[model samples]
Target chain A: MTATAAPFRAKRVLPGFTLSLGTTLLYLVLIVLIPIAALILKGAEIGPAAFWAIVSSERAVAAFRITLTAAAIATAFNAAYGLLMAWVLVRHDFPGKRILDALMDVPFALPTAVAGLSLTALFSANGWFGQVLHPAGIPVVYTIWGIALAMAFTSIPFVVRTVQPVLEDLDPSLEQAAETLGATPWQVFTRVVFPAILPAWLAGCTTAFARSLGEFGAIVFIAGNLPFETEIAALLAYIRLEEYDYNGAAAIALVLLGFALVLLIVSNILQSWAARHREATR
Target chain B: MSAPDMIAPGSAATGHGRPARTMGARALIGLAVILTLLIVVAPLVYIFARAFSEGWQVYASNILDPAMLHAIWLTSLVAVIVVPLNIAFGIAAAWAVAKHRFPGRGVLVTMIEIPFSISPIIAGICYLLLYGRQGLLGPWLGEVDLQVMFALPGIVLVTMFVTAPFVAREVLPLMQAQGTAQEEAAVTLGASGWQVFRRVTLPNIRFALLYGAVLCTARAVGEFGGVSVVSGNIRGQTNTLPLHVELLFNDLNAVGAFAAASTLTVIALVALILKAVLEGRRG
Candidate 1:
């Protein structure tokens, strides 16, 4: 009995276990892990002193600042707008609802370059929105605002998609009971619903932020690419690469990659924590 | 507080704790609609508006230009090679991570998804640092007369990296939910592993696989930053459609760029429609 139990615990019942996992690991190594390892190695070769000198340079600092500010702005807008969109999609029925739902995924489907081109055109001085905005004491393209808008456009789906399912799956009975207990509509949402979706919302915002940090293709066209003003960290890294400044490129890239990896891990942790908390409540 | 008025059991269920009709509700709906129009639909409409602003003949000629044709061909070629390879990787990763209880399964799943978080530009930088002329394998690649960077192979490799997780992300959850019971039952009845997978698992996950494939195809066709890093933006040799759009725009050929962009926009619209349909089917 002991020998049988021990063997069962140690062994997998499924066939092709090794084959499938081996293939997965091999592909992951060749395509994903090895390249990342090379980047890290390149960063290491730059050494801590030179790396600091590169990353802390004035232009690098300004790029990081602009990227962070724009991403923060984008994430903040999505946090509010995304919750509203999710709430509308899940709780309400209206004409064009299906179209609206499908349009939420356009950012994911649209190429970033096209998105940038379209956005820049739309907000340029003589362009559609630009014609309106430029005279109204507002301008969008070729500024930090343009960068944020592009970031927002590209990352809107992250927040909405994350929160939509959680909102949909929320039990209506909880809200019903809260209403029966004399909670107002606002109170019911704040007390009962918001708590339920908060973790997922936070996770979504984190991913959106990380995505905005790394957003390049959609931003450059509209960003004006001014050193220390409009240039983002990712574009700055690309510029470094173009100039054959391998150390500069690798250093900047490592920081952006580090932010992405950390944000990703944080998002994953929040998501699993949300899952576990939901299970416990159930 | 009017709680008593709202206390009707069936009524409360229908409203989900809100009034059935309220000024606030209408306003919220209106706000959502307007913002969606401004944020999502306006740019989309702008693409075609500007694309054909110069008239139909110019638009047609832009799309038919030899360079534009090559860009289209190159983009499609990359997609053709990338989507199927990613589908294979996605399935293998899903099968392993969802079905098996390996010691490092969670880490492996994370590894597979690493590309999703990292920027495409960073991904290109990684590859460049590993394979460029002065990179780790640069000497070896040069010695072998193999050019992975600034060429088709480089484009494909980076695109593959970016789109790797889509199929797995879509399929893994469904496989996990379906569980090992049916497969074990098949095994008990003397079916081989391949037979069990084909007769039992594949049928269940086919829609999910297709969903992932659609998504993979869209990303493969649309990828820009990562591919740009490696492809070196050669005029007729390696310029993909997205890069070509950038080039035309920089050349002050706004109409041509938008005309080219309209084609990609059409692809995006079709992809969105397919995704919506697939989501319904999967559900």
Candidate 2:
């Protein structure tokens, strides 16, 4: 048995397995792992005291707080609106539905800088939306709201795309049976539909939140970058780099990285939970 | 699974009764439309409006400007270089992770996806810490007179980092779904491994590969934050189109900025259209 197992392990039907896998590992290490390791090593060299000092400063703390808050707000909006959008695209047939469905990816395809510029232009005091919104005393540009708006614009695709396929794949018979049993529309949705899509919706929201947390290009353009106000952790790291404060930049970046890592882990866990729930239901 | 039948048109007569459109559903659709328009469509329109606001002659001149032309060239150059390298890496990684059962398969998949979640700004910072003047190899690199930070190579590297996972992410699932049956069959029929892959696997995954490349091109062309951090914003030197747009805007060359921006916008739109077409074909 040991001899047979050894020979089987040595045999691979496809050639170049070692070459392909070796190149893959080497490339991943060179491109992804080493650079990330460099970041952690730099942070470590700075030590905990200096790292804490940099990240715990009022400005840094404020930046973190604002980034988190804006991301939370954006994710909340996406959670509701993204669900609606997915439902509409999946359940309702409307004119221009395909066009609208394609449009959902514009933010993903468009450069973040362009999104920021266009958003800032439209929301500034003299721009189109600005003229109306500012007159109504609802200033969006150069505010945290602007930051959140940009975040929402760029990250909304995450929620929409994630929830879309799940919604499309949902068994219509389940809803039909519920309705046939004398359930109201609200009851059918809340009892049958909502439960089926909740895990994906939650996963999508978490991913959107994660993405918003790290948003830099779009936010920096419209965020006004007022240290404790509109400035985000990412911008702060850029600022530190500009000031030639490597330690400070590394420390702040490490914090942002920490947040991203936590979010990614949470997102993964939620996704697996979603997959497992789907399997159980099946 | 007949699932598509349930969602397709004529579902009303398909035994599973389609829910009648209610007032709430109408309102929901309306709200979704409005939100999408406000959040997604309006800005896209705004870019073109501003681009053409200065008339065609100005737009024409901005596009023809040597600096703008250089920026466009650099952006293409980055995409040209980065996308193929990423395609190779993606193919390699996906081939290994999807086709083989390994002990650390899950970890490898997660690691490949790490860049997707990490901020581009942080990605730039990581490269900086690795290759900057005062970086880990800074002293050694100075001896060799090599410049990796604030240069074209740096910009390309960072753009590659940000767009790394696109093709892999697109191709992996499709390959996994297809399995290795066809390749195994080809091998048993005495076809070479390369021939099996080139003839069998490639045809099956070609659309996915193209879709991935299109997305990668869109991203590499539009990448801003990571490029910004590393490119040093050297006018007519390291500045890609996006950075050039930022520079023009900062210089208050609104016409030129929007003009350059419009070019990038067109690239994005075309990429999207291609993606949609490819997706339709795949479906």
Candidate 3:
């Protein structure tokens, strides 16, 4: 057959749009949108007072405070600690450097429950690290400190993973330029390098913060899950579900979802800023 | 560190910084390593401590217990299905987004990240609403004898939702970095589109695909919230190891929960090792 020339030809300017779009729609329809829509539909069944009373109870309020506060504290710790880890991994080399770098991913790979247990084992009164800290009068396990520890364990990798790539992309000459202009090392880091990666650092911190708020498997072992004390939001939801309180569970979940969505907005802004920085340097 | 074949040839020399001009850099690195050791290394040792506390006999018994074995088997089953299915989804999504400039490409990408951002428990509730006895699809599923929630299908579905983005996220970046040159070349050489994808595109993205699968499987195995919410956490039936840990914890078998958790952690350690080695190779 001879090739026919037409005034308008469908040249397929974008590669594989039809095929990819088909698959994406299928996946999202089956996996995400449908399920989430289900959740909204279910919540629509409950009365407003029932939703409020279950979620707003003193015990539930206490759980929310415990979970949200611990998550914030953990995220703040990672913001500082993860940046330091990222700085070391990105900027320095020593013996077993690769091993140390590998260690950063432990939080990502390790299950939360195991992380909690291991942390507990090390910090319990009878454990190795606990024995050292006992005389110093620091209690870790069976407390909010343990909850924070679990969150920190799971949250560390988020900040490190996010910040590591940004740091690697950061040009050092800018910092040198700052240093040569009479900035001290601390001043150079704070004023120059830190500012550049701050958005990404904030993005990572928010992700960690959101994750710790929802984290359950790891914290359960260490948190002691005491109502109005060590109990967290997710654990409260679990307890509500255990008591067959579906409305209560949904209300708490909706609250967590609200927080997660807010954090998402913040991270989205930070991500775009990161992208702009990359483009400018490129 | 000296694995010559894996890393880009001579990247060390190029990427390596000059020796620290000041002592501050030295101390900072030193301090970071110590903290990392304190945080990461010490706890991992304790996982071994909990597992091997009573030595070989105890470890053998704890590990060989039927419940632990079942948890491992169930987790494996979840991983087996979740990884392959997600890989397919990832490839499809990545291919579409990377290869196309659609009207909703940005929206679609954002949608893909919903799984990662939303709590898994919320995901479970989503399915419960859609397919539970009182769910929207409940009548339809009942008419057809299909059970979506409180079953294995529910577990698989939620896990899939949670991990759906991993491979696509990994492959999309690599594909974007490489652009469409090779595929175009393959088509020019009389290769069919399918042939081009299989022989050229597949090989190029294989490493990212595997990397994504590893991450996906690790997550699927560790999944608790989504699975727990949908699964009903039935012991010996619906209990994945994470669920089992919670069950034991509730039962006041703290040691048993720790033991079960160690099993998952050990798997995580192996996976983490594999991931690092693979990433090291890729870098």
Candidate 4:
């Protein structure tokens, strides 16, 4: 191969490359990078032993346990219900289907604090649903159930939105072929359709779980902030900050951030896997 | 086999085979609908119900109260400042990453998305650690007689961080999909940089940009966790609408709290409608 001198510079067709790119880099560093760096630095200042001590303390452990447990329950419920909701929206047509579809986004749009307030009001002993459930020995407010309920409410859209598009784009002939081969409806769904959407469904659930883990405003009002019981990790971090325990707050925040980063990476991988599988099938 | 020969006659005759709705399917749909109503719609309806429970006069008076009014203004101010800056950052980031191939592009995108995964409360703590009275920059700030924590700047900064990814996330994919052919062609026709962006790029991404703006506005107006940590919840000063609702509820003024919440509920409703409309148009 004859070696020719390479051009010293690449050609760019678009203008503002430097201006736009420079602004983007500068802004991202100033806004996102610096503060997070500050948090990591603050955590470093405490050293590993002290940081570990703070995060492993009884109160911190309890907060993490409660947060994870409530988020798990909420994600479990959403996984089933969100799938059903997406299935109904895609497969069946009804008079109010449009309205029902639109309403799925309410959680995303509504303020978390308002969601917390209204949920607490509705589940209080004197409130409507609470009037029914409270007398039956079900205490929702100030309980773990309340935390789970709030988590489920705020995260319902994630699962539905993720699954709905997949369902809509699903080819119906596969299911029809299953039926023609004498498979039952449930068999067609579980064997054929579910496999196609499984990755997306799992990704959605993981994201919803991750979101629930970090939820704060909605859970706070209903949680009653009872230490060692209903207090979530996010709330505990805030409390630590309020008490001016910078190291304590940083340690707890680091743990939550770690969980979030791991879950996000997992979700991203699942999403790409789903996309690749869909392409391969096509 | 030829394409036509490969297709079975019976399969072709089936058109798009939509399953006949069975009784079980109907029942399942019905159950799902009821669950959606119970879980999603009830709390929304309850906000309005409780707001007007003490009569329209009481609701009106509660909203008209000075502290609540101040809270509304503060919330608006925060949104007004935060949304524009976020929009600028989003467009810049999206432009740089989506339009240009560069090293560390993935890293930049991930950094922008970090706030989405991290808790807002944690973000607030980051700001507190950097700018609080006893923070790293606290002494410098104290020397300058500047208050960053528990004040307006802190509130705006945290909200901006929490809502940073909205516009960029929305617009980036669309820009990537559309590619740079149009912009390049316009530039070849002697269009300037700003002209290419304004005429060629802006129109393409206008809907997505608006959608992101609406989402950013909704979040900024309703943000609680981040603002709460930084605002110190000072009544009639630092309190935003959501914080004020919390303040009222803590004061055992349930009706007043609901009334304030209803205002935010209305804003959320408007944002939802706008989003739905934009989605419909895009679809």
All candidates' TM-scores?
Answer: 0.94, 0.95, 0.91, 0.95
lDDT of 1 at A198: 86
| lDDT for each candidate structure | 0.87, 0.84, 0.77, 0.86
- In the predicted model 4, the residue pairs found to clash are none
Fraction of true contacts retained by every candidate, in order, equals 0.62, 0.55, 0.50, 0.59
Clashes of 2: 0
**Candidate 4 CAPRI grade:** acceptable
Cα lDDT of model 3 by residue, B1-283, tens digit = 0000111111222234545556888888778878888998988877777666766787777667788788778888988998988998898998887865546778888888877778787777677767877678989999999877877899999999988887888788788888887887877888887787889889988877887888788889888878888898767777888888777767866667667877787788887777766665655
Q: Is the docking of candidate 2 incorrect, acceptable, medium or high quality?
A: medium
Determine which window of 10 residues in candidate 4 chain A has minimal summed lDDT: A1-10
Query: For this target, which candidate reaches the highest DockQ against the unseen true structure?
Result: 2
Q: Write the per-residue lDDT of candidate 2 for residues B1-283, one digit (tens) a residue.
A: 0011111221111222234378887787788888888889889898889888989988899899999999999999999999999999889888887777656788888878888889999999999999999899788989999998888889988988888788888888899999988888898999986898799988999988998899899999999988888888888899999988888888888778888889989999999889777877776
Q: lDDT, candidate 1, residue A80?
A: 92
Q: What's model 1's lDDT at A12?
A: 65
Stretches of candidate 1 off by over 4 Å are A1-10, A280-282, B1-20
- What are the per-residue Cα lDDT tens digits for candidate 4 across A46-163? 9999999999999999999999999999999999998998788777766677778778888878999999999999999999899999999999999999999999998888778777
- Strongest candidate by lDDT: 1
List each model's interface RMSD: 8.9, 5.8, 6.1, 9.5
Better of 3 and 4 by TM-score: 4
TM-score of chain B of each: 0.92, 0.92, 0.89, 0.93
